[model samples]
Target: MQLSLPFTTLLAGVLLALNVNAVPVAQQPRMVTLPLKRMEVRSDEHPRILLQQQINRASKRLALMTGREAPTEAMMTEALRKRVLEVEGPEGLERRRVGLFGATKDKRFNRTGVPKNGKRSPKKGKNAGNAGNAGATGNTGATGNGGAAAGSSAIGGPDSATGVEVANTPTTGNSLGLNIEGPDVGYLATIQMGTPPQNYLILMDSGSADLWVASEACQSTAGGDCGNHQTLGSTSSSSFVASNTPFQVTYGTGAVQGAIIQDDITVAGLTLKAHTFGVTTSETPDFADDSVPFDGLMGLAQSTLSEQQTPTPVESLASAGLISDAITSYKISRAADNLNDGEITFGALDTTKFDQSTLTTVPNVNTQGFWEAALDAITVDGQDTGLQGRTAILDTGTTLIVAPVDDATAVHQLITGSQADGQGGFTVPCDFNQSVALTVGGTVFAIEPQDIALQPPNQDGSCTSGISGGSFGTSNTEWLVGDVFLKNAYYSTDVGKNTVSLAKLV
Candidate 1:
């Protein structure tokens, strides 16, 4: 969407020039942005929550895989937690370490109680035999706080309890909260054939794109743990074609073991000729976490980021020239519950669907994956308060606005007016009130009043709450502008156009 000329000032505008100093440079607003929006799927990179789920599911299959009496669930769970801590330690928290890039209990890192003085020592006291000097641990494999030693492969994902090297990536997430696995690639086709025909609610997560739902073959300790999603394998309308090859995935946080399956997958008016996907048979609660609607998930993110070795169904269709160019858009109308029932468009924004606006361009940090853009500044009552602070990461995954530690604190102070909430965040006295606005790209739009008062009440009647917008994540050094922020504006990412359009939500 076009920012009103009024929204953009000359100095803030993105300026481009050509041909000598002959012509004066034209100025436009520059949106401070992230390169992650650039396309390139780190599908192998799994979120912590998903990792926990995989670990949990893997615990269930450990007995079958190892052919022994598996230890109870809780034991495996604690072990995984400790393992991850050993590798990441607490320092990695600064980067808000999560996924593969951060500390995984699975890998190793550089750290120790004390360094060996500079000269090496010999195992046999030097005079005993001839050889390189060594400390007790033999080769002091580089120093890493997390994961396995530098040279060893960290089993596709992090270790759950203690960062140690293992020969192969664990096919089981048996210890995680939501653990399960089915053969990779082989599981994809089965789920497609299993899901019954009909509309279903689905989580549209960009990370590790693979679309599948729990089948009757699936098991969960949480009693029928699937979301508002339907089971494809259970439906007669459901079709299943099992591939001989198993489906396996190695995520930064965890892994998914399943099989590949291909079947008809449709969203809105869009339908695929033959979509390849996964059917997770492992037991885990991820699919059935809550009443969140959806028969399964839909991976519209780029293929490059896909967790699978095979091409993404969305990207495959886009390449074959099936849809309008792999452009997926959503209009969440919290107005009348459309917030939950919002539509997912495959090709482009259905202009006839809702209020449409001109698109703005954000240079892609990574051109082929999840689209991201620059956010110029964040304001409190129109003040350039958050500008000198951290930038905002506008993401579809998050639900609300999350300011940095400083910014989030200021917002809490302004809204709640409580000294107790100074360094920490507190909710406004339920009766207290104020406007919360964010300056994204160049436009300043205020967050809704209802959204501002986000915290629930406590026993003493003091309404302490989370940082105003979304959860305050210290790991990430930037502010998070999620859907709550997006709802105030019309947004679009045109990979072909190299443009991301934003307009007032109205």
Candidate 2:
């Protein structure tokens, strides 16, 4: 499939690079460790409410695919209940719940209190005592923020968040958790931009590469504006410089437009000098809605996928010799009702994030710059549907598993109760216990049933499914597997080697 380019510009132009001869070259280190912080960006919103909003938005896309008006909430509720019965039989209806959003009062859904901080106390993990070795410095077991007092070389570099030590690295890749909220909302990292460094939380997305932030000039319609989110302004930073490069990117749902600018970006204790990024001058109304938690997005896909036509942070790191490899790994955890957790490792894979030693690596098939691979086959309860040798994009920005119509129909038919909602997706029984698996690199990885449950049941017994039907390419075999499958597996992408590896997370 030809990789879809997200950004489309009205005016034809060229991005003129500015000279940076006077920029001071900063010293960097080999390895850096940053303890990630789990943020309650939307503390007041309930998970069910958020899920409902996502469903509503998805319905619009469904409308486009089916050539019909968006399904009404009541219609969706009834469709969900009917799908459950079709996929799971009469017994499935009996398994329905009457709790919040028809959620099974399952303790997992009602988790409360302050969520666990992503910044785990370094002293609590097996690596707690190993901080000395964990530090970028060699041989010395230097204690970090939460471990022991930072050795003279490490102490007081940055404020300790749960005893996390942020220091300069001589070289090597940096790894940090990519937090998850229920499904694939996104994992966020904090980067300080501008001269007097102001922090901006951005989503690390691999589906497209373009670093952008909301700017002070950002404007939205009456219905758009999410409250309290941060935006950047060049005037606030003494080091900020306008590159006069016009930039814009369109997302699956919205688009952002701005001009390119150069500033410093600090991530995982390493700073990239005179880094070029976008400051959004305009955005779609949806992005300003409360549903979005982060201020901006940071593209981590291959530079080829980038709209800026420049290297991404991960790519820049490699060019500057800050990391050992041009690779990125995602370990997205199930956040449930309270605790949001997960991480992303830049430059190299972190073995501790996975349950297995061997990674199933496959050659990337898309030349346009997506982490796409051939689908060996799909198995449902050990039965092959004969859907094999197809290609699919492994995307983290998406939440559902999307496949072409015929293939999706075949898979849905295998599971007794699944049904097409006339709207682009299937409605499956929340309680259905069928084994759904995907094969790549000659390895079959089973998907946990819970991972396929897109939305909880409502009081009326309606539940949204995690798998949907959408066409990325003309072929029926083209697919898109998002958090529905990613949360259950370990995904690694190496731009340098041009390969994508996946394994059961265990």
Candidate 3:
């Protein structure tokens, strides 16, 4: 069960050394382990529902940006089943390809003019610009390939795009523990900030790389919805320095606007002096809801993904020598109760939580701060479906396992009585007992049926499919493996080495 790291491509970033089988115990001090807990926001809100909504929204965003027509509920269901644009024969495929660019099934199906792939259509054509655009830009859904991360805002990309950007830079050192708030959505950490070290609750998001909180000088939309929450008062902190740098960030949930500033921060017994962060001047309606539990979010993605234009907490810790490497590990508890049992460790892996020497490390393909890897194929019940040539983004921020329509459909087809529910997911018999696994770096990792069965059955008592339909970008094969897959695997990421490893949790 020795962990094997196969280097395909090398990129600049932070490094993470888990219980490397080769790294002796004395040398493992470079890594640090932290306890994590699942914070439950609403007892009634199932984790699948919350995370599914995020995936669905992200999928629509990709479609809108790509200029795809809004899909009908029926159309979406078919797409999830990978039955869209079905070709019955060679003639049908040719006709379908012609219709793919712009021919609708209406009377004009045979009359409208559409060019072949990569061929430019007439300037007056509605899909002129869309033609030859095999390479579209945007925060792709799980099915995106060879594209920057969704909402990347990469070095040269738009400043306010989807996905987090990865920048190779040193960090301003600091450290502290976070308060576990809502497990149904995610975890929240309490960070000590300001001169007197006022405690501020923030969501610890590995998918994002920006640290922000509501400021006492903030404004909200209508109802006192700006969340009846505490704020970080600049005047109250003697060490606060206002930068007035305009800052804004968007998430699947909502967006926030504020100014960048530098202040002292503390977490997990580590103090970061003059750490740069954002103070919210305005927030979206989503944040203002009273149901929202956390005050702000502290991003732990790679430094390159930081939207505040500064180093992330882990990067800062690495720069300050507080941790050995730029690595993070998550152990999300699958318990439905508010046990607060999940743990997120920085700078190291918790040997207690994973099988001994069972780690498998793969190269990260994208530099946009997403923990993505090259996927070989997927197997259901020990049969390969040839779902290859795709990249898998290991997202802790997401709840369901999202894949390109075809791959998702293929996986769902293996299960008996699984069919699309018209809401970007499939409905399956709650009693499904099959093995679904993904082959990565030549290793086969199986997902238990219990993990794949989403809770809270429909009126018919059938459960929702753990696999959802979505595209990352122009690519037809991008996969987003969220908590559904992670709950069954020990996931770890090393920013320094640009590698993501997965081990079957014992």
Candidate 4:
């Protein structure tokens, strides 16, 4: 099946190819295909949860296509079943049928291995690609645009190395951050994008799926306030623009609105390619009140969350075939004092640079291709916390570790105990000596001393301003382990590995 890329992605590809015309076409937007494992098929087990979500999404598309309201989940499932039949005919979708997204009967996945449809998934399966997305014919997930790939293959590997085991491929010329720098995870992005906050350093997040900058256009009922984004036309920034894409980002906690623009968005020495950044034109004043500087935000979510959310710049680069592959993996650190400018490398993780072990990996769901892993348990020091190890979503996009509230409370209590703490969040003695360890992929990872000090429990010094309860909790059971846990580890989301690899930081 052929993949149909979004028009925006195609346009970006064309612009990039044209702007940097020095390279060869074959080399431009390069692509690589990695071998995938073929897993055994089963009938009794239920279809993977993600597949079910897709089925539901497809049903909505079907309803829209036919000019009708959306159907119930059951009805949607039935509709998809019927639609597959309509496309495949009375003989039924055969095992030989290829899915639009490079998914084949023989291809296996990390978490989503062996379809409920089994070997027949790709064989006339509905997943081959979306009939509408793959041009009008609906190639589904097939990469269009003369060989654009799904997710990060155009980069060094599947960002899935961050999540589940997936077939990660890479495009050419892009270096797989094989040795990317580890960034501090604790820094916060001052929401104030304009006006008061002028040159505040904000956290360049690659984890949480949405991109937002505090702006005056917020709809917070409490009041309108802008936090720390540089006000447009601010002198601190050498250059800034309002792209007119009026950006409004809705987070689990707040929202921001402004225009998208092409500006010089820089952090630490890494200057992002000239791209669409957000700025507040009309908004609530909460962002301005934050006292940070900047114009807007840069989205790092996967390409999937662009709709109804901040556009993921990272995924856009991948889809447009700009940077090689989606970033294979990322390293983060929580630092002392100021949050330093971290690094963001395209392609592979520089394994040679890190003093670590084998790279376990996982597949990344496109909505936001993040470094994801399954958590077997959270071990504090040498002890097993007995927390049920469910799949842990390692998101640079999010700020806090959102486990089941109860789980979070338990972990928080264990770390804080009856220490003399005020309100800055979790705190231990100034000279806490024990190491907090988290185990994944059968590996035990110990959190560094600084990382463990999450935050001092007081309104006191820099070291004291600490990590609060949950960074941001959602109304779900799935635990979102944010950068706090990721800082001490060298993580790679190798789609090819079908597993999330964890390595101890040197």
Q: Which digits, one per residue and each the tens of the lDDT, describe model 3 over residues 297-397? A: 77766767666778887788788887777888776656453332355667876676778566788998866666788888788899888776877777665
Go through the candidates in order and give the clash count of each: 114, 25, 39, 106
Candidate 2 structure, TM-score to reference: 0.68
- Per-residue lDDT tens digits for candidate 2, residues 221-244, read 433443234566665567777767
Candidate 4, overall lDDT? 0.35
- Candidates in descending TM-score order: 3, 2, 1, 4
lDDT of 3 at 390: 78
Question: Counting only residues 3 or more apart in sequence or on different chains, how many pairs clash (N, Cα, C under 3 Å) in candidate 4?
Answer: 106
Query: Please, what's the RMSD in Å of model 3?
Result: 17.7
Higher-TM-score candidate of 1 and 4:
1
- Decide which is better by lDDT, 2 or 4: 2
In candidate 2, clashing pairs total 25
- Identify the runs in model 4 with alpha carbons over 4 angstroms from their true place: 1-203, 207-247, 259-279, 308-311, 319-321, 337-341, 356-358, 364-371, 397-402, 409-427, 454-477, 492-501
In order, candidate lDDTs are 0.35, 0.54, 0.54, 0.35
lDDT minimum window of 10 residues, candidate 1:
15-24
Candidates in order, TM-scores: namely: 0.52, 0.68, 0.69, 0.47
| Per-candidate alpha-carbon RMSD to the true structure | 23.3, 11.7, 17.7, 22.7
Off by over 4 Å in 3: 1-32, 41-54, 58-184, 223-225, 337-339, 471-474
